[model samples]
Target chain A: MSTPKMNATGEKSPQTRAPLPSQVVKEDEPILVAAAKAGDISAFETLVSRYERKIFRLAQNITQNREDAEDVMQEAFLKAYEHLSGFQGNSRFYTWLVRIAVNQALMKLRKRRPNQVSIDEDVNTGNDLIPREIEDWGPSPEERYKQSELAGILNSTIADLDPPFRIVFQLRDIEELSTEETAEALGLSVPAVKSRLLRARLKLRQKLDRYFRRSENQ
Target chain B: MNCKTLVVELEDYLDEELDSELRTSIEVHLAKCKNCKLIVDTTKKTIQIFCNSEPAPLSEDTRHRLHDALVKKLGRPRA
Candidate 1:
């Protein structure tokens, strides 16, 4: 894997990073967690390395700032390693780690946006959830763009969403968290999570329509 | 299921949380409604596209900084 050179002290999130290898032997997370708890520093480092990219992405999507995301990622890993003893293994280590990262990301987001990203929270009345423009994207609409272009489009579209909707979508769809888990992580009700996720999907679909409408010639 | 009802139930239906009877109703409406079908298809694609995309890797300097901080705060990692 060739490294991209840029910045000092440093910060780097490239516009293009190759997709992770499709086939790499992955160790069981529980075993790694057990080893780490037993004072195996290498095992903990392995866990950090395994999840660093995903956690950073989650933070960046939530915070929409590279520098804050980097800080949040570092804090999340440090916090996870600190609290490793209390993890209890009731959930997947990754899930536990994700919860930590989500908390850190949300704090960064709230500090930056100030009352825009709410947990107590903003209410959407569900009155006008119906989408107006419902046009076929044809088959495999996302294939129309190169991966880097598509990534840029995805990040921008998601960034445009309200924080409530964006955070719900990130947890549910991107992070693959369960409804109960998402609600618990964000301190929202299960129904609220579902409704927010629905809005997020619809909002994102509408946003992407212009780019993927089969006639954009993009 | 009219369009409004379909939208109300879309999340549960997509997540397969709805009972089969309601699912059948939504599917029937989707079969007859072109717009609803497109909305559902595109929404599903939106989820897929986001889920499939990979996160960009951290720069070497940042990774090293994180590890260094961890080492200094806790202790050095075994080689």
Candidate 2:
């Protein structure tokens, strides 16, 4: 709650000047959170700027609408600011923020389609047959050069997944959140997150294998 | 572990969620089974490619609008 020290010129002291939000690293988050909780608006704004892109993309992935995602991002940040006092610091600030962003995005989706089923209810049972014929995608020096194209294909493939699987994959693999964090954010059980992630990864692997095999044939 | 069991558990194996005993069993099976080994290796590669891929960046306009909106809501910063 201590105020940042100011120099004779009325600018923040060099030691107290916060790093640019983009330059803020993980270890600095708790300090930022404490500052924000102490009514430092700039501190909270730094948190917003740090996670804005990631939250926007998560929203976009969930809502599948650019405008809706933008709206969700704004709303999520506002909600975070309002609830900043309640953040217990038990979880990482980003994880808490992600939970809020995810809830906002899902709420937007539900508002658009009131009859949608819960994502967890549609979970795959994890008993799907493994394709016996999956071709080996051994390391190839040339394939490393096609990363951009692979990313595109991977994006489209992820988009093709059912909502439950896609969200799980986006959070776990793409965003690289831990299984527990993803489960909490999605309001799913840990086992459910693991199952959905497995199915999503297997599906993506099958698709990529087919693509590589086709390219090899050509 | 047999191929069917190993196939079913491959994802867990790769995720490191399997207990050490089961993990060792899978490792043993993978060493002797070329097809299972191939599946595991390829699946690992698939995950690597996706994880290494970057998500799309937010546009400049969106970034600016977000910042401006926050600044307005939070009030102007004091020097």
Candidate 3:
């Protein structure tokens, strides 16, 4: 990856960047989509080959079960095939397909589990002239890099978060999705996504720092 | 605000989704309060790490089974 170049807001800008290749889909995408819509089996197979892996992974993440994920993926593809004519290309095919997969995965999850977490915590905005202080909850950058591998620390900490927090964490934090996008995907308000994301991050950070501290002593 | 009240609103502050007045207040307090500063810093880093994570891949067996089921359901010839 190229070093990030900052803009006026100090957020990274693309212009001060290396010329990376664009990630536009291959030129054949529209052709294949059209043919698939017309019952061209080969074209449909190509689309399946292209998107199956992504759809499967999304299902797996949501369901967190191999068998359930497999079922959801298969069902999503079949549903897409039947409704291919209705595929208006409003969004990328994969985005639409993933939505179907998410719905199916959540359906299966809801069926097997009757319990949903209660989100009773009121979003408290403090009376301070300035908002409440926000602090870092995780390890220092140096400690993070020096401790057990980042991957291991992340996995254990993520698993330790509350269930709803874990789900939001997985979808937004891990997925690198924007707040609005995550909110739309999960049917939550933007405020709700922000709240869960903060809580999830704080919990994980605490867990990671504690884990590394213990390991360092041992 | 005291630490108790600040802690409760910490979520909105981190997101920068709070109103301007609240945002400034929080920033001011964070600059002075070492404890709260540590929490915010750690929280931001934790999320950055989590969001930057590479997604795990599906196992080969699961992939194979999914493909087979799709082909059977569609009855399409293998490419």
In order, the first chain's TM-score in every candidate is 0.85, 0.77, 0.62
Native A-B interface contacts kept, per candidate: 0.62, 0.41, 0.47
Clash pairs detected, candidate 2: none
Best by TM-score: 1
DockQ, 0 to 1 scale, candidate 3 = 0.36
- Per-residue alpha-carbon lDDT of model 2 for A1-218, expressed as tens digits? 11213333222222212233332346778999999999988788878867887788789888878999999998899889989999998867877888888888888888987687477685545566466765666564227446667657776777777788878887776555667777778778887887787788778777777666544644
State which candidate has the highest DockQ.
1
Worst lDDT window (10 residues) for model 1 chain A?
A9-18
> Model 3 TM-score?
0.65
- What digit string (tens of lDDT, one per residue) describes model 1 on residues A42-69? 8898888888888888999888898998
lDDT of 3 by residue, B40-79 (tens): 6666666555544444556788767766876786786447
lDDT of 3 by residue, A1-218 (tens): 11212233223222211212221245677788889888788888888777676566566666667788789988998898888899997645655676677778778777766575333234332243222333333344535453347656665566566656676766555443446656676787776776676666666766766544434544
| Chain B TM-score (model 1 vs. true structure) | 0.91
Q: Rank candidates by TM-score, best first.
A: 1, 2, 3
lDDT of each: 0.80, 0.72, 0.62
B38-74, model 2: which lDDT tens digit per residue?
7777667666666555556789888777777776678
Error of 3 at A119 (Å): 9.0
